[model samples]
Target: MSQNYPNILLIDAIPFQGGSKVATRTLLHELTTEHQLCIFTQTPQSWQGLNARFYPLYMPRWLINKDQGIIYFIKYLLIALQVLLRKPSLGKITLAVGASGPSVDLALYMLKPLLGFTLMQLVHGGVACSKTNARCLLRADSIHYLPSSRASMVAALARYGITDMMFNEPRFTPMLNGLDKSEWPSEALMHSSEPARPVIFWAASLLKWKGLSILNQALQELNASDANFSEQGFSANICYIQPKNIALEYDEPEDDSANIHWFNQPSNLDEMRRQSSIYVSTSQQEPFGLSTLEAMAAGLCVVIPSDASYWDLALIDGANCIKYRPGDSQDLRQKLEHLIKHPQLMISLGRHAMFISRNYHAEQVYLPQLQVIDSYLGAGSSKAQASITGVF
Candidate 1:
């Protein structure tokens, strides 16, 4: 193995779409400056000076969903075959990062025998039980957790009858995912002694897991309350920023449209979040809340589920943000009402939220990834090989 910078194989099954793909692009843009990076995808992506980008055999274009699930796994498998055919020499590539977790796992399963590259599985603690997870966990040379709690991973591994002691070797890289500071405001806006605008802003994908139904129920109840003074020319106090709004988007039986605004995704989300007094997220078991982080950066009182999965990302319910019971509209309404009545508490929590969010900035957060890469490259194949293969 040469002492020069080791090459890296970076594969995100679905490129040019979604949070995971966007995260892939961000890391590629950052890492390409120093390390050579080769990305394999069914989708074409252009990155100047990137080592290589390959588009292997894939399903027809029409079949590709931006939210493609099982198809992504198949694409990764095909890409793996193509990469294996390339026949990378021993020590040619020292490390590989799985940007698209499930898909990458399938690819690495096939590629492990063909390539000696150290495999790292990027995880958000727990994944839903699947054949993909069972296969991938066996091949990961190292586990790189993104704001993933060790306890959760341990429990997840236990599902496959894999004990922690099996991979007790020094083979874990714990890091929080990075957020682009530029997307957020320069500084948190100070709360004035005057009251904040009586507005609540929410942004999320219109999905059941996102807990929109619960939020809609809360709004339905809230709109029935005194906040329904919109008839007196007051603007809707609840503005839901999703392409397809919740039930309140269309005319309902109670005609609650006046009290709730169903707006499309905003062009300038940061500015929109700043204009609002509070930002709420109802996602249950969210891996990492990027939109929630943006709201925190904007100095808005951010509220989320009490059992939000990523607790280690400095999310303390009453300390920096508010946590309401998941799927309980009554509890959500009560939490928001408390913030409405206590202006000082809102300001205090918002300020703390912004402070906590700064730690997630790309500069502060991505360092661990870079370090993990460097350490792997520095150690080379013989000495620092992780137990990428673990038997049950």
Candidate 2:
């Protein structure tokens, strides 16, 4: 690798591939051409195809749980120490440590000064108000947060007595998750005629906040309302990945409805989206809702909860998306029924959504943010500083 190319190291403590990891993967894919990239992750297999060096941190199921406080830290320390000993030159070569959240990479935060790397913190969800987290955020060279998380992040900082002056402009920036245009279907596929029976797609981790139960109730009601629901109602494709170590209020729905299918973390989710006509989001106050954005990009008429989330605010109901009352399964059922009754409206909404998705292409959305990262890495010219002031 050329010395002029900045070495960017991304730390991923999470073992599974969630929205946060997906967003990180998208950004890193875009950055491959301009910089030298490496990933330190517990699950290296998840990042197999990316052109980056990988340092696997072996973590068992017990040690990986966030609830294991001191034991978790000690296990991480032992594994990280082994890696450091093997690759001492990493300290001098790395230009920045990219953390997915405020405290996601706690070990990196502790070793940042010794390793001589700048910190770039990306807030994917609500900021936890804790002294340790506040200290990590304060030390970060740049903090990129979603618009929805701004209030919570500010409040968290305030709890630690951090003044407004300390967390302004270039140091703190708001960003949205973007879609990879190459991964989506062609325009022809996007504008294809509506399917004979619309496929209603719902995908997310089976966490309580994701509202799987609400979707189940809505689907059940929709089925019960019509005797020939299997033939007249939409075909439902429910895809979910069970989160590790999280307690759930209800088990997965066991409806024997012929039209409903349950998929457990399908590998070809994009293909599934391509075949679907409508995408439903049931998350409660989602921070960024990357899956919802991707569904829009895939030309699916999205039905999202009207909870003032990032997507709810970005998409106009009946124009690009349809919104139902938050936590109201009956309302959600009604919305689905309305769309089923009017197929053209669903097609129109999807077309409009596909057009809007172009503006959020990863290359266009992440360029300015990447410039800010490059500036800190001392790889780009002074134009990056101008981007810092203008972007946000």
Candidate 3:
């Protein structure tokens, strides 16, 4: 590590194939341009060519595995000391950490000297909802929230007397959960974009909170609707873009919608973008809807379940995007049927979504945020000094 550049340590579960991974990578790359970055991750397979030192903990494969394995338990204990020692000897050393789930948040918090380093807890929703997140926020030097628009986590922490410090206050900054626009094909490829059928995209892990089952039910309800049935000459042609296994699991059932056509596993990102006209996400407790951002970047109108925590960041009903009642199949059906029938509306929404997408570009959203980290690191540990008042 260079003596002039502030050395910052980032801790999170890696093997980053999802939105969290994308956001984390964007921030790391941004900071590395000026600061020294050291990363501690669960898996470092996907990290290549990044100017950062990586340490892998080798965590469990799944949520369930975290509870049963002796190796995981041992790894947890070792990670605490390893992470604790990452603090710099002089100036300010910053510690940025997050858990894939709530339990890990508590575990991460329990191991520390809060004052020796600037402690920041990054909450991505699922883990933030639990008692563990509450405890970590109460104990940490600062908290960096993914969805800055909401007062939920901030309110919850305030109730416990954990008010925001200057460095740790909640922010509405986008987590840089988007791709580099230049990496995509030219605008000419966008000319052929048209809704051939009701092409809907769902890109998320096959977890219960993702609401794939709810999406399936909503599609069935749309098929059963008299208005939707009569509008399409009593025949609805709906195409679903998802993973192969999930498509097989949900599409093969006897009650599955006959109008549904499944396109599983697009060869690449362009293929995935081309196969769909609209993007839909219904996660129950998303911290930041990265998939929605990606879809919007690909010029698709986004329809998100109203309950997702991150929706407050940019989504507005019938404005930039549309929202359905969370877990309400009928509401989702209504939204989908409307968009499918009104291609003009879809086009308008897609255009608006593209406009909204620009605000979240990694360069705009991430670089500025990383500047905050740079400021903190450059100023050194004085602002992070432990409060003597014992309140806030």
Among the numbered candidates, top TM-score falls to: 2
Q: Pick out the ten consecutive residues of candidate 1 with the lowest summed lDDT.
A: 383-392
What C-alpha lDDT, on a 0 to 100 scale, does residue 248 get in candidate 2? 35
lDDT against the true structure, per candidate, is: 0.61, 0.75, 0.56
Question: How does candidate 1 fare on TM-score?
Answer: 0.73
Q: Which ten residues in a row have the lowest lDDT in candidate 3?
A: 383-392
TM-scores for candidates 1 onward, in order: 0.73, 0.89, 0.69
C-alpha RMSD (angstroms) for model 2: 3.6
Report the Cα lDDT for residue 4, model 3. Answer: 69
For model 2, the superposed segments whose C-alpha errors exceed 4 Å read 1-5, 89-91, 185-190, 245-256, 381-392
Clashing pairs in 2: none
lDDT string, candidate 2, 86-185, tens digits: 4554445455555467656676776677677887888888877766678888888888888887777777778889866765667888788786655654
Model 3, range 246-293, lDDT digits (tens) per residue?
211333322324555443333365565655667778777677777777
Clashing pairs in 1: 141-388
lDDT of 1 at 163: 76
TM-score of 3: 0.69
